[model samples]
Target: MVLNVAVVGAGVVGLSTAVALQQRVKNVKVTLIADRFDEGTTSWGAGGLFRPDLDSYPAEHQSSFRQWISDSWKFYNALASSEHSQDCGLTFVAGTLLQNSPKDLGYSCISELTHDFQKLDEAQIKKMNLPSTFKYAYSCTTVITHVPTYLRWLMQKFRGNGGKVECRKVSRLSQLSDDFDLVINCCGLSAVELCQDKSMYPVMGHLVRVKAPWFKKFVFSDDLYIIPHNDYVLLGGIKDAGNWSRAPDPAKRNIILSRAYAMFPALKHAPILDEWVGLRPGREKVRLEVELIKGGNKKTIPVIHNYGHGGHGISLSWGCALHATRLVQELTSGLQARL
Candidate 1:
């Protein structure tokens, strides 16, 4: 018999889970439900670079860092090579990580695969037009994705394969009946209230998108980054932990723009297209687990939790999706049969 799966959340993580589940099995019905979709999601504002700082991952999780990163890179890199690359906002970019502090960014292992992994010299530093003094830097050929484009592309791919999307809010897990074999929660920030997960909180952030076609490289300094995509450059941002305000602060907007223009003087000539504010679904570590939600009449529904990607939603979307899909398969197939 075919399985019915409901994936809650239309963000990158949820959409990726829906696509992966459908791809993993045949004749399965996948319904993706979320209150917000496409351009409204926090994923839409992400520069979508593939760097995962060691601090981003939880220390206690059983997931292998190498496996997740390798799998995600393979998936996006394949798309980057295909003709649909641009349509999906997957492309190769030369990135520079300007070190402003003593943070241990874990890109060393993958440096060889990057565009260029070299310490900056005095001459290169002078030409970079950056204000922060750095002792070391890593320049790499990395991947950046435009989340809005990618989300639309993924939805089309899922629908083309018989999946469905509903623009509705899921206030409770029980709202989805037992008709579905499993319900995967990819609701990001909403997961905190839906699941009563007090551990989950929001990391407030903001960004400015401007016309900077002349810029082609991605720059990173601490949590702040200025990445250039096809037609626009993304200037970001602050990461305020446990903050939930969705409104952009005027002071932050000015600070971000000033810093970005300082690094790339040409941006001063470009006009700002838009400013956006979002809450990165943050937790001590990303939450990806399985639970049995007991409803009225002692009915138990299987729920696979896959939220809390923090600021790295796009960077880790595919990896977590693959992991969640595996868990769903286990719950539906073998010893873990019904909740």
Candidate 2:
């Protein structure tokens, strides 16, 4: 018995959920329906660093932080070490977090889950070509997924596994109700209007892409982060909540470039590749739950809401996807037996 499942949105979270369900569930046909894909998505501009700031989530949501982070790490780290990692934009990177003051970043989840997690010594910090203003730093080895490359790879993998994709906007979940037995809503910020979820806000963000092949590591600060990808370096950014404009702000872009130069003087010589602006789905915590949409004739279409990950989308994608997959399995249990 084949269950028809439709996944809304095409970002990392959406694609991850689509792939997870296709691989985890039996006799399920997944059709990825989204308005955007690859570089067109907000996840495309993400730093792609697999680090989670669990403190960003509420206390109740923090309970699942460890499980999600741990599960995601295992998923990506395995791909990072695989033979075809380059094809999938998966790679391991060592990064340091610099702070002016010792503030708890809720590192408990990553601290216990990551392999090379520890505080850096003064000597090690001094060796970096960064400003001397940092008071403390934590060194950790984490996996990074170049979003654009990874998204394309995920699409390929999804299609390879008999999954389907449709490039279009979904006006309402009811539209999919007649066709799909289940719908997984990973529409990110659009969920506000799509699901009538007023709690979701848009966190406008800015990013600058630079050609800094000379740098091999990543750095993080209070408001700025520098992530080195294979061919370019991702520098960013500012989080302006409630701002929905997709256009890049020149003033903010200039300020970020200036700050990046101030942090690492060498970036001043590196050529700027591109600048981008997008919105993150801002919510108190990630929404990963199931809802029953009653349609005509008393038919119930189970919808699994998986969005509101904000800046942690790439980090929490697989973990939350796996959780959502469990819900799909649960909803289809009786149907599988009957069909």
Candidate 3:
């Protein structure tokens, strides 16, 4: 018998999981359901940089978090090197990360996995046009994804592989249990309501995309960053936890532009292409475990949660999707054995 799987959420995590599922599982039908897609999702507005915070997860899961970062890096690196890099919106860019102190400079988790990770000297910083206030900095090669374009590419790839997408909101998990053999929840912040998870909240982020093709590399300091894509550059942002509003605040946009312009004087007069506000699903820890949902009439469905990735959704997507795929395989195998 063919297994039918329902993946909730069409964002990066959900779509990635669906793609991975179809690629790895045999004789399976996968459907992606979400209320929004492409530009309507938070992933669309992301800078799409591949920098994972080493401290994002708890101490016990640190090893696994590092593995995810490594896997994600490798995945994006391979994509960047492929002939379809431009079409897939993947590009390798070198950048400098500045900090007030050297103690806070390095990401120890996957530092070894990054390309050309090195501390920068004062001379190097001056040459890079960084402010003199920056006492320590590091340079590394990282991948950046043009999110809007990339999401479209992912959707096309998924559809081409026989996966289906449904544009609808899921009010409850029980509603899907009757039809699907398994349900994968990658609903991001919506998991708070869908799973009734109090641990999940929103982290409001604001970014401005401007026409600045000359800005060749990424520059990050504190919570602010300047990420350059093919046609435009992304200037961001603030991380206001517990803020759920998606409305773009004009004052906040001005502040971001002001700070970014201070760092790179050339951005002072760059034409603004678009402004965006997104709510990143923040949690104490990302939930990526399996649960069994028992329904009426002696029926049950396996749910593998893959949400609460917060700002690192794009960074950790493929890695977490691969992990989710493994969980699906194990759950299916166990079910088959029981039958």
**Most lDDT-accurate candidate:** 2
Better of 1 and 3 by TM-score: 3
Which pairs of residues collide in model 3?
A: none
Provide TM-scores for the models: 0.92, 0.95, 0.96
TM-score head-to-head 2 vs 3, winner:
3
Better of 2 and 3 by lDDT: 2
Q: Return the lDDT, model 2, position 171.
A: 89
Off-target runs (Cα >4 Å) in candidate 2 are 103-105, 122-129, 337-339
Considering lDDT, which of the candidate structures 1 and 2 is the better prediction for this target? Answer: 2
Candidate 1 local lDDT, 1-339, one digit each (tens) = 677889999989999999999888655789998999887787877778877666456555524655666678889988998998999989888878877554444654356345466766678877776666776677778888977889999999899989988898887898686456669999998877898999888888888988878888888887568888888888996888877888889899999988877766778998999888889898877788898887654666789999888877887789889998888777766423443
lDDT for 282 (candidate 2): 94
Error of 2 at 293 (Å): 0.6
lDDT of each: 0.80, 0.87, 0.86
TM-score: the better of candidates 1 and 2: 2
Which portions of model 1 miss their true places by more than 4 Å?
102-105, 109-115, 121-129, 335-339
Per-residue lDDT over 1-339 for candidate 3, one digit per residue giving the tens place of the 0 to 100 score: 688999999899988899989999887899999999988889988989887776556777777777777888888889899999999899999987778866332376446777688887888877876554888888889899998888888899899999988989899887797788889999999888999999999999999999997889898877689899988899996999998899999989999998897787878778999899999999877799999888664578889999999888998899899999999888888766554
> What lDDT is obtained when candidate 2 is compared to the true structure?
0.87
Sort all candidates by lDDT, best to worst.
2, 3, 1
